[model samples]
Target: MNAPARLRMSRTALLPVLILVFCVVPLALASAWTLVLLLIPVAVAAWVLRVGVDIGDDGITARSLAGSRTVSWTELAGIRIDERNALWLVTTAGTEVRLPVVRTRDLPRLAALSGGRVDVPAPPAQ
Candidate 1:
């Protein structure tokens, strides 16, 4: 692909979180110390908005709340699936980078974007 492919967490998940933030407003107003409670929701929203995976010409990038890391296609050893079903990018150096907002269902697209660097197994015959 000529342009980078971007995968992000669904914004719909933030709806309930935002409503919950509104619920915290009254309590925050009640006490000066309680105002600090607002940071919780703010951090959650920031996390949902900031975390994602980006596939470009150079390689794949994993972004988090505080920072991001990139693994060039040449350095990508493979992908790993944890017991919790999270996807992680394993580098040739043996370091693993968690890919946020990327699901197992997205493997085909990921493979395509990786230009065959990542492989997806063929389904079994019926």
Candidate 2:
């Protein structure tokens, strides 16, 4: 079996920092309201970071506490890099799925692995 290519969860870097700055720092500064108000962003960040991705010879897989999905390299048509710098895998069905944080920088790498190109498409008109 081909060895699995491990990718660390993206939230591992950002969540702690946000928690420290917004939650811990505010509490340290003795601001109750700040801590309370920051909770929303903190929760959202936590939720966002919880998603992770892994790649290997079989293809690419995204795992989260919520669920897991494996996408074959062939099934992945291409990648779209958003203005926000988010990388999404384009499926043959024309649906776009956001890659996990760990796979953010992995776009170019994935493109290289799939022998494809990385192109950021223009956003649709508002």
Candidate 3:
């Protein structure tokens, strides 16, 4: 099988994250307590910048701040887009696996990677 296609958050999305990190730098330097609080934005940045999804012939691998999980194509019940335009994977066990950093525009490539197991939603009418 071909190598998995990896998807990540857009670079434009990292601008706000970088700004927040810089804004928190002084606070983090001020005191131990503030330094402790700095972990929040750090984690958010890690999630935004490092999180990714890999789609291959065998399965889908989702990586987040927590960890990575791979679900085989056979295990997937279906796929759908939420109101927020996030793509979700529905497993046969009925669990909903949210694909982080996955936007509506990424669906076509994801569908191709899934070997057509996922149907790309039609664009909305004007």
The candidate maximizing lDDT is 1
Cα lDDT tens digits for candidate 2, 35-119: 5655566666666665666677777777665777877767888776788876777788887767666435555565554434334
lDDT of 2: 0.64
Query: Candidate 1 — which pairs collide?
Result: none
Question: What is residue 32's positional error in candidate 3, in angstroms?
Answer: 3.3
Global lDDT scores for all candidate models: 0.90, 0.64, 0.84
**Roughly what TM-score does model 2 have, to 2 decimal places?**
0.54
Residue 14 C-alpha lDDT in model 1: 98
1 or 2: which has the higher TM-score? 1
TM-score of 1: 0.90
Candidate 3 lDDT, tens digit per residue, 1-126? 699888988768778877888888998999877887688777877777779898888799888888888889899988878999888889999898889888888877888777888887676899
Shift in Å, residue 81, candidate 3? 2.2
lDDT of 1 at 31: 95
Tens digit per residue, CA lDDT, model 1, 53-101? 9999999999999999999999999999788768999999999999988
**What lDDT score is found at residue 10 in candidate 3?**
74
Candidate 1, residue 114: how far the Cα is off, in Å: 1.8
- Cα RMSD of all models vs. native, in order, equals 1.9, 6.8, 2.6
Angstrom error at residue 14, model 1: 1.8
